[model samples]
Target: LLEYLEKDSFTKDEILAIKTEDAGLTEHLEAIKQAYGFGYDSISELIEELEGYLKSLNERLDYYLNIDFDGRSVVGDDPDNLDDRDYGDNNVMPKNGSIHGTHVSGIIAAVRNNGLGSNGAANNVKIMAIRNTPNGDEYDKDVALGVYYAVDNGAKIINMSFGKSFSPHSDWVRDAIAYAAKKDVLIVAAAGNDSKNTDEGQYYPNDQIGVGEEVGDTFLKVGATTYDYGSGIISGFSNYGKSSVDVFAPGSRIYATVPDGKYRFLQGTSMASPLVAGIAALVLSQYPKLSAAELKQILMNSGLPVVKKVSLGDDAVVPFSELSKSGRLVNAYNALIMASKISR
Candidate 1:
């Protein structure tokens, strides 16, 4: 808020008046006082600490508000039009040359044993790039159409590694998910990297309109996990909830291919989501008769259980089982075995 005022050239007295009159700021400052009472020995010191925190948020908001890149002209479509689906061309590459999509693709199906970077989660798979999400928030129309394109183009499993806090046109994406469900296509999505409980504040493009009320049975929301299977197994930044996130998967320090024919290590629920998507693809490949619903069930039910306490956002400790609905970390071998039994 302070940064925005400075950006718009507000005077000192104006800023002071706005701060003094802002009810939301007063409520937030009071909440902060309650959350960290007397930590700084007095109210003045606490106010000073809170001012720093507000400055951090101000800077972040200003950064996002000032991004110069515009990707709308590349696709050449009316972003507000839900019916304008025949817009994007064959070019699926990132506008800014970001390697995020490439990294996720490699994590799902990089070629194995050719003396390259590393083997992907699946052996044989075909990739379809939608390229809708950009550096920041994506349009709802684009996301909805992307799902439609994938399902229509013979994509049996769709991997979505992007999410945002708000979705003004959530129904469009929700309908697209339902369309995928009708076609027996499974969707694997990241639960976001906010480290907050999704049940309390949702990440968009989810299967649920409200918590626990699922729109489709084929959608899987995956959370990130660390290599450590101990009390701190949950990734420090991975969003979680027993009612929102479906499963956990290894995401921290993941090695995969990047653009320009290079490879690197990265981490997020983005990586974790594709790992599960790759597993789903592998299971479907081996058990061709399995339906999308069955495949989702197999992945969820076959994972290795983690029943210990896990450290979540900030310093809150909760049972690992409370992190995701399945209370398990995705296991490829176990999923394949479970698929075999179900197929038989």
Candidate 2:
């Protein structure tokens, strides 16, 4: 019953004939009409007869190759292919074709109950890959377009695991994010893995543009945490900011999916972002009726808080309480438990 927007396949009046026996149909369909009202929009089918519609998406949007969210971590790109394309290496390392994306993807959506390394947050979800980013600082244009692509293609939740300190057109990226908000897309971003206070050092594409609360309530920024809840719980590479970072999750020496049908250990906020992403995917998969804004709140309100005093990095050991908004780690079991409680 799922059908992505393929406007070209049918006339406007023909499209209007599609219907559902349930109650939310009118509201859902009307949202689609407004989102895809412009030309060049598309709608892709998801489970439960749900649909995904998109507008001007990024070129890398097609890189992810799945219809359902299955908890997959990817390195983000093909190192060998990228070299052929001749993109310089000033921003990132396209190592292992998608080691970053693959690992991050694994953290969130690696096949569950399959006796794998670890279970992803969302068990029955569809992953949509939009490969607009590479091993370096992504162009604002690509990030913006990629945001649009994910939102357009029916990604109710998006994980941005990469970021740079500088940008030339952050405004465009922010605007695209705003557009996703209007469409009710949840965007989860990485708190750069710089091991510094984000308040002292800022990262671009952040939700806070010195603007008031976002146009729509569908944005989250996450930090990284290690395995232990004791000292040094915050990954040595994680960046913390009370004003920016919303929460933290497993990101150090963590194992997950990688390119070329492989898996390995990796670190960074990249890993953390996907953990939240996977959780969001699970939330949406189980309860597709939840809005993007609600999903964002679900994460923040339900994260696993620890009372341990932790160290941030090599020489800075601070009380973990002041680190981020949630001051907690992501726990799938706990999250589901919370979601159930909130449902009432």
Candidate 3:
């Protein structure tokens, strides 16, 4: 769809003025215009947006075709070896042009109300950015070490916006998760973007140990929700699970800071996770004594439940209640209300 839109050089008004003979092309043009808010003033904006989407698609294709691709090879560390912790440097920023970590960081803490880019979900919070995830799939060893590093360095909240279909060292990461939990550091994770049920599949760095067991109480898995609140509210590409994803947050077309201090709208469960993390940070700012487990419970119990039926994927139309463990969307206002009550 985006590819077709990119090939056309016609302005928004030009496309709208033409009476297309083909019904399908007209429908596609209208949908694209609506989705992107393309107008006479924003034609170039639309083109830039399509370019980003195209670049992402190309990277994904490269990831699949290069089966031997190892992002960690440059660091000269054995990714399979759990004991290799001495690798990597203090340079947390991406060496390449990857702005994913920057975007996630901005979602959590972007110097609120500076008349800059966008206001983050939480105010008066310092961001501790950790760059463990590479441009491609992250190593399990890197993730485990990153968790430990964050928790040990006085970070009360850790947002992990990356996940993989496989985890060869699940135990290593699980142990790190437990270690953070013991230290009262809350860990927020993305539920992935596969558009599949996570309960039927497995994405690592999750708190779940088995079919029905959870290793830690402080971990929260977040799913993506569209800006629309009614039917078809869930994002089309968001992965969901009744027993796995803990809550939903605004992930569709979320505008946040990217590399080199630029802002753009990106969508994924990754964006959703940091939004929840920022809320958790707000709750903690007011109620300093609340434990990580207490914070997680407050977030889950205080969210707004969505009763409407929504799309799970292309074919399934399930009740919104069946999409997540809490059957609720994270509401920062409601969460703060509950947090104040708990603090009292």
Q: Write the per-residue lDDT of candidate 3 for residues 173-228, one digit (tens) a residue.
A: 98999899999999999999898898999877787754578888899999999878
- Of the two candidates 1 and 3, the one with more favorable TM-score, higher being better, is 3
TM-score of predicted structure 3: 0.88
RMSD to true structure for each model, in Å: 11.8, 21.6, 3.6
Which runs of model 3 end up more than 4 angstroms from their true locations?
A: 1-31, 34-67, 70-73
Selected candidate, larger TM-score, 1 vs 2:
1
Cα lDDT, model 3, residue 149: 89
Candidate 1: what lDDT?
0.83
Model 2 error, position 291 (Å)? 1.5
| Residue 181 alpha-carbon offset, candidate 3, angstroms | 0.9
List ranges where model 1 is wrong by over 4 Å. Answer: 1-76
Task: Kindly report which residue stretches of model 2 are placed more than 4 angstroms away from their true locations once superposed.
Answer: 1-96, 210-215
Could you give me the TM-score of model 2 versus the true structure? 0.69
lDDT of 2 by residue, 75-148 (tens): 24433231222332333335544656667777877888887677777776677766666535366766877788
**lDDT digits (tens) for residues 1-344 of candidate 1:** 43545564433344335544568777755554553432233444445545744664464454324466455667677777798766767787756535678889999999988899988889889999888875554778889999998999999999999888878889889999999999999999999989889999979889887696787889999999988888889988899988999999998768899888988666789999999999998899899999999999999999999878988768888888888899999999999999989995
TM-score of each: 0.79, 0.69, 0.88
